[model samples]
Target chain A: MPGSTLLHIDGVEKRFGGFVAVDGLSLEVKAGEFFALLGPSGCGKTTLLRMLAGFETPDCGRILLDGTDIAGVLPHRRPVNMMFQSYALFPHLNVSDNIAFGLKRAGMARDEIATRVAEMIALGRLEGLERRKPNQLSGGQQQRVALARALALRPRLLLLDEPLGALDKKLRDSTQRELMDLQRRLGTSFIIVTHDQDEAMTMADRIGVMNHGRLVQVATPRQLYEQPASRWVAEFVGDVNIFEGRIERREDQRLVIACHNTGAIVAAAPRQSLAGEAVCVAIRPEKMKLSRQGPAEAAIQAGAINRLEGTVSNLGYLGDISSYGIALDAGATLRVSVTNTARVDVDDFRPGERVVVWFEPDDCVVLDP
Target chain B: MSTRQLFTRPARRAAIAPYLWMVLFFLLPFAFVAKIALSQSALAQPPYLPTFDLTAGWEALKAAAATLSLDNFRLIFSDELYANSYLRSLLVAATSTTLLLLLGYPVAYAIARLPERWQPIAMVLVIIPFWTSFLIRVYAWINILQHDGLLNQVLMALHVISAPLVWLSTDSAMYIGIIYSYLPFMILPLYASLAKLQPSLLEAAQDLGASPAKSFWLVTFPLSLPGVGAGVLLCFIPIVGEFVIPDLLAGSGDMMIGQTLWLEFFANKDWPLAAAIAVMLLGILLVPLLVYEHIQRRQLEGKQ
Candidate 1:
């Protein structure tokens, strides 16, 4: 159901004093799409979310909701709602009353408001806590109340700022699952702001990675991880071994880089114009196979030439996977992870073992400097 | 110890020294006042009849107690002057407290919203008047409100008035004096409450589609009720029993209860009637205090 642009932020900029919180940021969210603004803290993701929720106005540019620029509109008048990170439920109001606040403000009929509040209460699984104030509820219950209150109005767009930040791990997982299910069911366009990459990768239909108040790249989670737009995005999204090098040659949909760390690296599916001399070859930790023998003997894809010889310097056994820090003879350290197929630690590489690490050219992302 | 006893220990362990002081200073004096209120005024050193010493025998104490009656209270009820003064005092207290609230809430809110470093400075400005003698400040108001004073001169120079306004010895002067002296009392508690209000709550209300005014009334105002209750009580109780401001600044046409009580005690030397009036005023004041206490307890219970 993701069709057409539901919201467009065109070169929006916000500044507090002289510090640019959000600088010339542009994005488009599709209708019924779960969009996440992913970044580190102080990356202006929350600021952009605040602007969408009408708590702030951009110093320049436009925020269009359904093609209507809503700069002059007040927050209460805008068809946008937000679930705050603090889950700012009204402490004075009971659960039902908190959920009914927006409906009441919209001047809905009393009976209709009551019905909507009851539905929300049922949705939040707060059946018997209708008359309990926010302070009386647990953290999860308060989070539910915040969600019910914001969703009660049925706004066009719902902005959530780190909605699961206050929850414990178990609650966070269940809440994330429930949120994804609820979004798919309601088909409401949600733009959630979070610094947690895992939450973004799992829940978002499209993730926009922000850095220094700018959108570095916006793509699907898989695309972002596999082919990041730059070395920063490549390193920021996930753990990757970036070999800084110069582009030596460009063949048909293929390129070779003379790396400073691991020497020449052949990469495939070279999408960008191979115009820049300096570039970085980004390879995911799991893409490379490690073996005491060669790549073919290790059951890796045949004819793979992105190979290097290194000694295992460090080993991390994370129960499900074993990660190895390999120090190449050329003096570069690369982290490689392999799935622990056997339960009793069979065929696992150890520290100080000399190993051959190799990956196919397709697994390598050639990014411009 | 049992859980019940453990839970009850704090209340039971409340410092006994304060209670002892209260007995020596407040309770004992109040008991003497009540005894005098029930007795008849006489042309004696202490000015009340049927007085008994604690060292006296029980028979003597009983004889004195038998002579004590409700005649003072009966006289106060029958007299129109005391009733009228009581009503005037209540009206003044109510109206002045309303004015104080209207002026103080916004100032307190502004101070609370100031920058972090400036908040204490703003609070200091609000309480700066406390550094001066309250009597001197009220006396300063006397100079300002009197004929040919600074206020009238400024007004006349601005051509806002043709003649000097009769500000002194009027209800307006009395109210001005009361408000000036009690403004800090109204603002301090209000500021404390307002400053503690989280900014996220207001933003949440706005985010949830409540307008600025709606958010204030719905979230901000209701949350600050404790401060409102405290400020109202702090201003209302003393203003109702106020004697100095009305005696100094108000006209003699209508007397407040404080003035009437003072006249009865000092000029007329009717100590019994004055004691009865003081007890009645305290009774009236206690009504609001008890109501406030009940609300405070209910608020605490609601939190739990």
Candidate 2:
């Protein structure tokens, strides 16, 4: 549900001396979309964000904002603002004055600045603490002032470098929702850079997973979770048990892979894989059902379910569900989770019990190893 | 006694040590000076009458106090030479401190912004000038500022000036000497504060549509006020009482309070008036010293 593209990054490359922090990377962020650049530390996500904010000049290529190429534009001249990870609020200025900083720089009238400052204070929910300096406020309050200061200019795009990094877990969660709501209200394209996958998944409309100065994949959160484009993205996004295999045969829509560890498996083929192609069959733990007896339900033998027999090696009871680590006879470990419907069940399985972990063929994701 | 009480007793003693030291060394010395300032100048062993004798008991102390007068302080206020010296001391201190700030700020800022590995080396370079004796440094300046000195010779050779200028024994030379001597005092505090300034604050200012120059005025300059106050007080305080620089580099007309006090004590043999002058100088300097301490304490509390 993203609109037209607002910021188009074309083949941007940045190098600090000989170490290339960001390779030739291209990306497009839609208008009003909360796009997250998700990566591990040192993956060049921060470099790309600095380039977008005009803090760092690209070595090559162009960044177009609303169809205007912004090459050689200085940070202050560019219509983009960044919220730093440290929540670098001006310590000398109060909350209201900090929010009014950009407006005053733009040469707005005093009354206009006051009104805008008031509006931003209200927007950031900083009503009573207008005169308190940044150090006088709490960490979460400082973050709000940083956000209000950045947004006061009404930039077409807002770049946040670990926006919720300084907040505690509870505050980070609430702030994530507040940020999403703010983005929707302001209708500005927000490109947030973070290493936390859960933060990216919870807040971003679309996420670009970066690895080693390159974009591995750009997709919606659900798509990135369910259909990751590579093995790295698969493991980075969520917990998945990957079965290394070579495709033995290809039917019309399904592939039967002769796996090295989990034996033969039938999975829906990726769009580009061929017969004998080496790939990984990835299945999320929550997708598989664990049963101690032979197919407690009749769905296991039905030609659709891919079933593997194993012994329960470990069991974890998390209040809502039970997770079982099953070691297959073919020398592979597969994790299976079952919902805890009742407080206690008569058929609950424990360690050393033989089990059949079953899943639909469509549930398996074929990813490049 | 309980273990907590035992620990608290020694902790309390340790905490009170500094106050005791200040009272014994600083306040008691000032009290002696104040007592001397209130005495009468006389041709005696101590060269002042109405001495406080502890062994003579309270009756003798009362008799001594009855003879004490504020005549020396009254003469200091009424005398033109003393008043002019006080005013000139303030003027010299203010001007030299202004010059030091102008010269020190950029150097301190450059050192602060240096690469972390080079910062220590740069700071050492600023302080290396102090390794030489201060008196020798002032004497060296006098040699260089003389008519046939290195500066005039170099300037004459470069055709910048046609003749050897009268650079020695002037107010300007005294100003130069004071500024050069106290520059490290200015730079060190400024460097300490500027180095601790968060670079991200400037970056955030720039990101919020402020230019680099604007960011400095809006963020960097304001944040460095603690250092500025400290540097100003450090330079201004000692420069007011600076005797050697003005005595060596300046003419007789450029008399500061320190030179005045020295002349009063040694040449004029007026110990009471000299003590009064010293007490007044201390009173004048105490205000800024207290202000500097307040700023340092506020900064420390903010860090916590």
Candidate lDDT (C-alpha), each: 0.90, 0.89
- Runs off by more than 4 Å, candidate 2: A274-276, A294-303, A341-348, B1-13, B290-304
Among all candidates shown, the one with the greatest lDDT = 1
| Candidate 1, backbone clash total | 0
Tens digit per residue, CA lDDT, model 1, A1-369:
469899999999999999999999999899999999999999999998988888889999999999899965788889999999999888888999899888988899999998999999888899999999888899999999899888999987999999999999899999999999989988899999998899999899999999989999999999999979888999899899989898788777677788998888888856766456888888999999898875665443343477899999999999898999999998899999999988874977778999999888999998876
- Residue pairs with colliding backbones in model 2 are none
Candidate 1 deviant stretches above 4 angstroms: A246-266, A291-317, A326-330, A345-358, B1-25, B35-71, B115-117, B268-272
lDDT of 2 by residue, A184-257 (tens): 99998899999999999999999999988999999999999998888899999988999998888888888888
Native contact fraction (fnat) of model 1: 0.82
Candidate 2 CA-lDDT value: 0.89
Residues B192-261, model 2: lDDT tens digits = 9899899888888887778999998898888888899989998999999999999999997759999999
- Clashing residue pairs in candidate 1 are none
Which CAPRI level is candidate 2? medium
